[model samples]
Target: MERPYWVSLTSGYDRNEVLTDLMRQYGDDVWNFAFFLTRRFDAADDICQEVFIMAFKGLYSFRGESSVKSWLLTIARNKSLNYLKSAFIRKVTLLDKVIPRERASPSAEAVMFDRLESAELWDHVMQLPRKLKEVIILDYHYGMAIKEIAAMLQLSEGTVKSRMFRAKQRMSELLKEEREYGI
Candidate 1:
């Protein structure tokens, strides 16, 4: 895909306008990838903010070797890893909070979600190893090509393809096991 027009502007682009444009175009992708990596809703927000700030500041240095979205993802991945390693994060994270809190009653959206057969697959997807999970999310959830994923994750194309294969196999096994044992 061609780079965004903003990337080509040599001058006269207002800083806010460039930042706004980046957020408008790729904000959801960045946020979702952050959420996938960190697995904490709160951490994802912080990571996304940091990702955009860094992206905007470093936009000039962006070498165009990868898509801007992948570049943002690399930033998100770094921020997420830093967050995960922080002492505050370690102190604040606990098993109880990591387990999602249930609402007092289901909302319409939740009720509708309950009817989807594939919803449970997401839970299984979460159980995969981090490497496998990352590949699955980037490839399927974000619709990233193998080359994009490899670039984002700094893996070889063959490695990315292998992880994708293993991730799907593991998901199938998880579902089969759940059906057999009623997990």
Candidate 2:
């Protein structure tokens, strides 16, 4: 069977159809990258929305110099960084304290072992400096090649590898500390 018309980028697809397909293909990866950068759920949502808008508006200019996924992530990374620099974000500090961390039901804890371990690992990942954290997330979580991450972040391949090494070492130390303290 032939592929759907919208699925083939070579076809002269309408803007809306192309945009929709791009969103479906890249949305989760974009959102997760944004969330890692922003460290806040609401900001991730806003960044992801803005990314698609930018993608839609800039679609015609896309040169296909990289994969669409990489191009979309570059847009996402730029939007996320812009968000971090906004004055409104700088002045606001309410989300962390306002959001409750605990579950109402005890049943949640019953399944917590696996989830908690994963959560703790991510929490440590979050605590790393932004440079280190981004490397770790892109390299490990997103499974991108070091070369791709270097291009996406505009760093040298050696720099990306060095950052990844430091991130892993730091994470190991953090996990060891957690275990020693019985956290």
Candidate 3:
């Protein structure tokens, strides 16, 4: 029987090997979570890079109590919050004005089709309050268990459940309003 990759990585394994595997497996997830929290592409890139660096430096302290993905996401969430609080971040709004949005090519019909299909629901999800959005993304989009989410977010399981319920209620209300408006 083979041990799981993370199990081997945490059990006195080679540092480079463990770091490489961790980055390969969870890098995109960490980046996506950061993007969802920050809503800025550049910030997400910085957050993702910082997360891997922190994870590598703190690797020995990892107790294997949670899945590696959850641990990485916790780091990402903290870094994103810290970044949001920094004065340096406030000075960057000027750059937003200078950056031009990329235009999609006309040949990208599949991309357009997919966006049109999911954009409405995703837009509603994005409109949710930060806490509710985090819970919904972690639970539904990432398929994390409720217990894992509680551990990752440092919330009680009941709190996580309540947030999920509230998020669903809010989403339902948004959809109802859209329907009434014939949108």
CA RMSD per model (angstroms): 3.3, 4.8, 3.8
Give the per-residue lDDT digits (tens) of candidate 3, residues 1-183.
Answer: 112655435546787887887888788789888988887777888999999999888877877788888889999999999998888876675566687466456323235436676768877988999899999999987889999999999999999999999999999999999999976
lDDT of 1 by residue, 1-183 (tens): 444664565556666787787898888778877877777767777889999999878866777777777888889988988898888887678754777565587554345448867778877887998889999988877788999888888889999999999999999999899999999
| TM-score against native, each model | 0.84, 0.82, 0.83
Question: Which runs in model 3 stand beyond 4 Å of their true positions?
Answer: 1-5, 8-12, 94-117
Q: Please state the error at residue 133 of candidate 3 in Å.
A: 0.5
lDDT of 2 at 34: 91
In candidate 2, list every pair of residues with a backbone clash: none
Cα lDDT, all candidates: 0.80, 0.80, 0.83
Ranking by lDDT: 3, 1, 2
The TM-score-based order of candidates, best leading, equals 1, 3, 2
- Backbone clashes, candidate 2: 0
How many Å off is the CA of 85 in candidate 2?
Answer: 1.3
* Residue 175 alpha-carbon offset, candidate 3, angstroms: 1.2
TM-score, model 3 to reference: 0.83
Candidate 3, residue 119: Cα displacement in angstroms equals 2.8
Worst 10 residues of 2 by lDDT: 1-10
